[model samples]
Target: MRLIAGATAALSAALTAVLLVPQPASAATQLIGNGAFTSSTTPWAAIGQTTVTAESGWMKVAVKQVVANPWDAMVAAPTTAALNPGKSYTLSFDAYSTTAFKARATVQYTATPSANQLLATDVQLTTESKRYSIPFTAATATDTAAEVTFQLGGSGGAPTVRFDNVSLLETQTTRPTALYVSPLSNPARWAGDPANDGDTAKAIAADIANEPIFEWFGGWFGDITKAVDDYVGAAQAQDKLPMLVAYNIPNRDACGGQSGGGAGDATGYHNWITEFAKAIGTRHAIVVLEPDAVAAAECVTKFGKDPEDQYRMLLDATQVLRAQAPNAWVYLDAANATWHAPDKMAPLLVKSGIANTRGFSVNVSNYFTTVDSETYSVAVNGYLSGTVGTKKYVIDTSRNGNGPYEDDTPGDNWCNPPGRKLGTPPIRQLSGAEYLFWVKVPGDSDGQCGISDEPAGTFDPDLAMALING
Candidate 1:
């Protein structure tokens, strides 16, 4: 329902359906010396109102007084190597407090009053020891005399803290193999709804709810950061890769269709996407960014706005996700196989920051066969061969079993086409595609077109049953 035969307005006013990690890196170079504290505390020191000792292979600190700030009482050690700007690093350590409290782990210059700080993160401590791994980029210039310190103060009461196996290392980005299966998916929720009982719920659970699907997010979200944090936190708890669709862009659905709302303007879009990326933080994720965004730029010209402005917005969004959510694998949407030729779409994607992303996504929220999408994606990759290098792609295999609705007119072919069945189930590295995802929820209505009169994005069980039966 997102794009028609061409990147133009729909025949009818069809409403488009709306839809961490911080794990340690492997094969990294340790940048901190004497991290295990096995021998003695030579370079380490207890800063204020505390006693530090190395014994039993762990550094123990006994706090003598409560302080106003965490930095008031700290256990600090100088780094063995310099930290370079723009390089990714991870700080991992095992720690526990005699009493439950909070502390700060900071990376800064060794000077008494450092001018710049590279990383400072708040950490919660419990009676039981647990390992914490934090990933961050060096935001400042090279610091040869930097130090890693643990600030244990401002807890309203003194508490003893222990640390072990502390290590700081330079790391690499690794994509996750397993996709997260959220229990919060639309179909999964529908299956559990009291109204949907017996066979309906069972069918949904078996055919759709069990599959991992991408969740769509946009400007409608009130607390965008919390929403993103909750979703990513859930995925991290399960040690799975979460998939998301970022659909909100200013002047979205510029075709003057039902799915027309977005952030108020370009600045609003940048701020919104920035917060979204920050919430994902260091967690691993797959983002299908702004479906139809690149393709629909052509329509923005009719609104008396430069299409280049839209491209710039998308490119900024890509940069934000790249810098803020380092572990996330982003795929800029390239519409579909039928919308634009590879030559036409290639340059658009390039201008829209495809180079900053993992790759591009095709056939999002649309009905297109996986084979056709693979062909189109391969062609686009060919055009981008020298410019963007070897880029990967994903296909939306939600509902294209019967292909396009040939019986209907070209204008209405994309909206709720009857006889359409669920395509291949979502899988990673399937048929040369990086991933095949249910980008479009299978049972959701496209608009008041073809067989469905429901509003866009509303669930229709009867329609879902038809697709499943086929």
Candidate 2:
């Protein structure tokens, strides 16, 4: 009996040493070997009608022709190890092509019947270089040899594609710190309104008054500094982090919609953004910088304005905020999932200086399910991961509880669609995003739409009541 016990103990000790001792503990670890292609493309190879070569620091793939299917011309490399079943992984790479085209990327079995894919998604490649991230859970059986592939065919013509910094890492989930629940939010003010009496006011107080929400600042506020400082001060006194929005970019809301005014020009915008950041000073704050600035840059062309000007202004704004408010976390707005695909928006984000800010925010002033917003944000991160490094993102869950409103008039879907409900209240450390914020205050009218006649930003109690009840 003693000999048998000793033998069993020795085997268990050896297994533990092999499993835990040699591998250093880390939240995330790279799973792809030779992703940088610094020296050569040893493990990476050409597939179909593509030729792969390591030039300078990139894996350059020259496609001979546009084949019938995307996978007909491809470049593939094997992962270091089999992906764990049910484990989430993020595949990020920096890529560009000689011409703009759509390609496909996949993680699949390396051997015959490679059709057992873990993730398959479209990659939008443009002339300019950009990073992309694709987060997926390994659902299929673990295959010892799996390859990460980029399909370059089926674009109607052959375009040479270049890839660098190809990285596949196990995703690590993180939570955020407690967010500040502002005492001065519009709902709190309404709860104390003179005309409000019993049950109605009580519901507003209990349901919405105590929730965390953001305060927006713009040219409408005569004194930006004082307004910002006062709000930050109130939150600081309670030992809470304040949430703010700096929405005074030049040519703001270029669509010339209801919320279409901004500072006069570049110089005016610089001065305004500088003061806004200065007001936050050394305090801890979460600022969503310019809601629609980058996403709406394309509309500026119709007015004979260069989109580059908007990108430059935003770049400067990020730099100013970084230098001025060192402790503040600024999330550049990415509009929402419905507005732009990850490919189209990623380059814009890069051009707008996404690297200078903490990350980006999605679904501001619009209703999209948190799930859809998360998928878009993650895909955007895939594009950003290779360029500016992996970035954290936040989603605006102010009023998307019931998802988007589908009406006969599709154009007015975002304009205060009736029957919309309040989404998940403001919280931090949620999966998919760093935080779920009420960036757009609920109950605010979307410019004389749906059940309200008030202009945008005007607080309507009826709208507020309906949101709470929903």
Candidate 3:
């Protein structure tokens, strides 16, 4: 017994050492903070004695006014990190307006002083403190210095802004190892609203299986559950994991405001989730828990009453579902890019026991562009990592082809807006997300709330084909 114990202990230690040692061939790359700005006060000494402030480990430079109009503050990386051509790297930072601001920022890498090439430029400003980043590949530039500069003058009356925590890092080696497809037809339909027709759920599942990762849909709705079961059985026959969405939102559709259905109370919601998880019974599926529930929390409160109990109910449902479906990867739905800031939402999610949950989903029902989606993803991811200390997410790439329609008219132009093309190809691994998925099927309308003419839950192949082509 002593000899056996000794051998086991020796094996465990050896395994630990092997895991800890960095691989020689793929030597772990060093992430150096070039102008990490941790130690620089008025780091833009050459340009001007611009007042730079550091708070909560973030460095901020505020440009009071660009007297000459082209004022810029630059921070450069110590060395230009070498990136293989075609390989992607993520450059990220936190930025916001001290007041309402209209300036733009650029991230550039240069080999020669005269030959600086811009990697990403003119990122627009937003009112909220946002995290922004872009993926870029290395060009032929051999310069050892990479610089981030802010062009802080806009329209003369634009607001002053601040930026901090600038970082550039190689994309993760192990990107999203999976992909999940939402099984339900649309938000209203999934919620058991009268708007759902329910024939296309199976088709959506089949289309999702064309990708390389896991596929799923909601199994909580009566019609949706039956379709998902058929799809799951078929996928099982072919040995594939079907993904699912749980939509039984209480006071769904905001009391006839927009999309609505499902459970009417806390007990009903929790019981439904529990029953749904059990009915699926060990099938390989990635379940997305409740679409638009968290994002629409405010609406729910406005339509009904206090949402504290409802949120608690969701927390209970999450725990029950996780416990029942231990073999399943369960996710929460993040409405879209614009609804909730990650930091604001992370605490709520964590308080609701999101740590036991798999991760969250984003860009569910908005037409934000891929770039904006990534920017939002980075901001949310930063909040999750920095505040909530979680690093898992999924992105919805359903109808973000042409970006958000450049109109802010107030109704729902974001829903099924026209002239949009498909954005980046859905990839497994991104900066902070676990997977990229088509949570919303393109053929279905975003309801008549927007400019789309098609009725809810109806398929428009022309729109679908345009998305495919775009």
Candidate 4:
């Protein structure tokens, strides 16, 4: 068995190799040899006498039951993460069916299909041409099979399905700005009398169109399980995925004071996240796991905290959270560029179980520009680099238009900078981020900034105004 704990030295060496050897500009590529079916169905095959035609830029399928045959399909070898293994990959294809009929899409272990070979057969398609990708853990990394296919049969009559851009892609890991991501989040508090310290809207503004939000479930709170369940339920009620910031590491915010400490210790955090995962249970959520946990952990010694124990929490947290929230997209927290260097942070990240999670998040509650965050992410991913390296990032762009404050004195600038404006609004797609989010509540207090009397976590109208208008 390849135990991750025992392989720390190897991971460190691999990380060193990643940094020393210059890598490529990108690692993502189309998994399908001929997904477009542009000129020929070279990689695809006609299943059980089914007919498939590769036309202009798409593939046309016609399947009919001849005798006792149940279904017919167009199958192709499936490389799970397509270009990269274990890269939060998703299956995507544009399809237009002639009639509103039920169609089956599945991953088979081999061209000669078997029951155990069937990976997923739950997706159903309609007549309209729409882009599709399952949000749940319908396709896992091990779902890699000999052939995945689209089937049209076992119906009243013959069915015709036309498909285009059929391919496997690393979910959330797109080139600079090529792929348009479709994952969603954001919630302006859906519980009882909560502080809108950073929330500009009183009621989450139902009239306003949808936008993604990321909430960090940090520090030690009451009933970890119940709290997360409520968060997940609330987000789903509003038709949004909860971007849960899993920020309860024991030595969290090691470099900052506004938010430090976790659920007592590593064992306490493991217990907390275990219950937190139990609460999440199959919810369609986006977990931005442990902001400042790893980056700041670099300073554990300064605070009399154990860095090894903190790393243990990160490793346990990733495995537990993902296993529990099967549908949730989990990202490890990598503080903004203003915080740690990529080389310094990369080893810490890999050591803290970055490879186990979906990717990482940067600029969370910090005043770095989106461009800077992207650049930082590219460098970090490079440090964890490989042709199929499975590391992606999310940027918190709630407020950064004016960039970071020009603080040189005590340099406590990040806490409510003087003239920072709102950064890019949360959207379904951002240039490099899996989801550009309003991670930190835009108007939240950054621990008084040495100027305002507003207590930490209290609503500050002035701070809100500055972010909204400055």
Candidate 5:
């Protein structure tokens, strides 16, 4: 029941949803030699009155507009080392101003470096210290070194800026061994809210600790961009790459008797995808686009909307995502091993921008074995052997470890398959697979498997234990 004035309730709900999900922390890679200023600023270039002794553990600068230096007032430093291209990097540091100084920091790149990009802005910094972070994707093919320039002083007058605990790190995002559980498909608030209780946290603690989690998207209504923005922020906070499932195809998950709904119509989906793309922005992500959108088109192939039409939709969606979030990688859903023939699926994938995406995923919500999925994927890859680019696929190892339940028919028992074990947790470069991800949250009931009375996507303890324990 919708409350009459539910803004307060809505806000509370939004806050609660974000809180249950914990962020994952990542390791840092250093590039600056004397970033901390422990020793004299040898590797770091300083002009005018920039010295290490001015502050306890920082480089204090009191510089003016000088001869050919051309900077308003700042201290600049170039990396004594080179940087790897095609990787995005972030630099963070603590800054304090003796007075009200508008501070800005610029980072420079290329083998022969000069000032190019500005990171931090001219905010009025007071005596109190504040942390500032800046990230840049190295698109330059020949960037050999990196440099940072800081404007410590205000434009109004000569400024004094001090920096400490400086760190530069590559945005270390690899495929998940088990990415931090994300709140995609509106999972039980934390990872996948299959249990629908606060106590699920008490239960998930043991396995989830090191279980690199991934998130899903594409099920919400209204402004989903806000949710994506929130989820991405949370993932970044934990240093995990947020993986999303773009499931809101115009008509998705048809004969499977699952959540077979989209935003509204085909036009409706286009609008939704537009916002979805904008929300992701330039943050790094791994997206599994439109699960079952292409594979299940036979269920909705009526009137004018044929399988080819669905293919067009998926192709357009990938283009939108690529144009909007350049760093984010896309993976189309290739259905499961049992669903489609490799030849049928391969051509569809190539048509739906497979070359543009990282790859496709399989067995997203089924009890299929990883070995079988890999075998099927290899056959499909063979079909498009020379056509697809880089050509790899991810498997839904979320629930395939002990293997599938003995089904009467190969088509039967995808929902809440009994005795299925949690498969391999998300791992990077898992030989045949790109990443073995928890695409389907383990504990959530799959459309009310007869044994359990819980709603779809809610936690089921019996199912959870079978998968978790195995």
Candidate 6:
């Protein structure tokens, strides 16, 4: 059957159809704190006459005692909330120590008395305020009877510690829709150069059916415009998302006269960021802005000069990209676990302007345990939420199962350290972040460059297999 319609009528119908279509979901998130305790009506009991104050989405617990150990108390969820079998959830809270004291906190999750219990124990505390997340997965269970308790302990004299902003949420189970590969298309190297016969991009798409997050090199001090265009065009043709990594740090690679090149100045770098944003405008892409930029700032400060200014430029670049690519997801590179604290960095990110930035990425290069990374992420996100009023973060779980074993062998051996494996399955939502992605391809070389170079990104078939199965 055929129906004929006039051009005006058809156009009117098309306009109506467009209006009916649902727009893409925005990435706005909500903050959940201790004040929203709905599972029980009983208020948290103070320990040993400790004073408590509720402020900024947290119940600040404080204590004063000179001689003996002082501890503050908080009630766990009163009712038992059973976790679905084989499902995971993240539990997080904020804690801070006012003085130097050996502090340890215990969070007990009451589960069915079974052989395998999902409980987190003996978490350490620091002088600075921080948040911690403990992830639990439930095994087969018949009845629902589970409760979680959080306890803080201090050693020696009474040192006051505050606790606040506790929350529990079901983690998302979906996999990531994109991936980012770094140093893949840099201009200087054989593997990074586009002209190479065995570039990682084609290999990834062909082997894994996953597109590579292309990181193109910019000019001496500016954005790499043409490289982005080429990669984006090729990616679109293959119906894949293009991922980018910005590495044009001033005096790049420390300008220590290493193989890494050096940029001219901050002004040049800022201009390059602007150019990069312009080139990537209005495209749906995933970007890892400045790998190790935040964590590796010390090197730039020592050698490249003006590390603080460079970080400011990086933040500015993030803002520019957000405005330029409204539909794109912009992620800040947390680089690894050793980088600055999330709370400390979040304020700087906001001060430099993060209203448009999507979220931050953790464990970019180093091999921090997934549990440890999650804890770090939760703390960072908590600080961000408290200060900037947002809850969002991303984690990199490329090769972190066994974590880097402590070795006194020395000499940058951690780069391609052996015996490391993959972690648990990647969760989409954890501690308010959107997703945990295997951003670094497991099989790719970490630029060990050669055997003498101390194996960077060394390929591990065993780890790769584990990741695939997970």
The most accurate candidate by lDDT is: 1
Tens-digit per-residue lDDT, 1-470, candidate 4? 00000000111221110112112233344456676777887767777746778877878877654323345444444553323233343455677777766666765445245543334554456676655443223233443454567766665666677887665543333222211111222223321235543254442332111344555565545545445654554444334456676777765666666665567777878887877775666545677887777766667788786787788889888889777667667888887774667888888888788877878888877776666677788888888885327576888877767766664553566666677787777654524676677777655566756445564545455666666677
Q: What are the models' TM-scores?
A: 0.68, 0.62, 0.53, 0.57, 0.61, 0.50
Worst 10 residues of 6 by lDDT: 1-10
Model 4 earns a TM-score of 0.57
What's the lDDT of the predicted structure labeled candidate 2? 0.78
Best-fitting candidate, measured by TM-score? Answer: 1
For model 3 the TM-score comes to 0.53
Worst 10 residues of 2 by lDDT: 1-10
Clashes of each: 0, 7, 20, 5, 19, 5
Model 3 poorest ten-residue lDDT run = 1-10
lDDT of 1 at 297: 90
- The residue ranges of model 5 lying beyond 4 angstroms of the native Cα positions read 1-178, 181-202, 208-210, 302-304
lDDT values for all models:
0.80, 0.78, 0.53, 0.60, 0.64, 0.51
Which model, 1 or 5, shows the larger lDDT?
1
- Model 2: per-residue lDDT, tens digit, 312-408? 9999999999997877899999987767778888889998988999999988988777777777888898888788877899889888887777756
lDDT sort, best first: 1, 2, 5, 4, 3, 6
Model 2 segments more than 4 A misplaced: 1-176
Q: Write the per-residue lDDT of candidate 6 for residues 266-367, one digit (tens) a residue.
A: 787777776666555554567767656665556665563766776787778877887765546778765555456666766655654455677777776456
**Candidate 4, poorest ten consecutive residues by summed lDDT:** 1-10
- Clashing residue pairs in candidate 6, if any? 223-272, 251-263, 446-456, 446-457, 448-456
* Per-residue lDDT of model 5, residues 1-470, tens digit only: 00000000111221111112333456344666676776565565665544434356677776543223335456777765666666766565667776765666666673443443524445456677765545566655455566777755335555567777565556555532224445443333453444545565545544542454455456553447545655654565456677777778776666665565676676777777877776666657788888777677777755356777778878888888888777777888888776778888888888887777878888787766766777778878888786874477888887777666664554445666566687766666636777777877667776654456677656666667667767
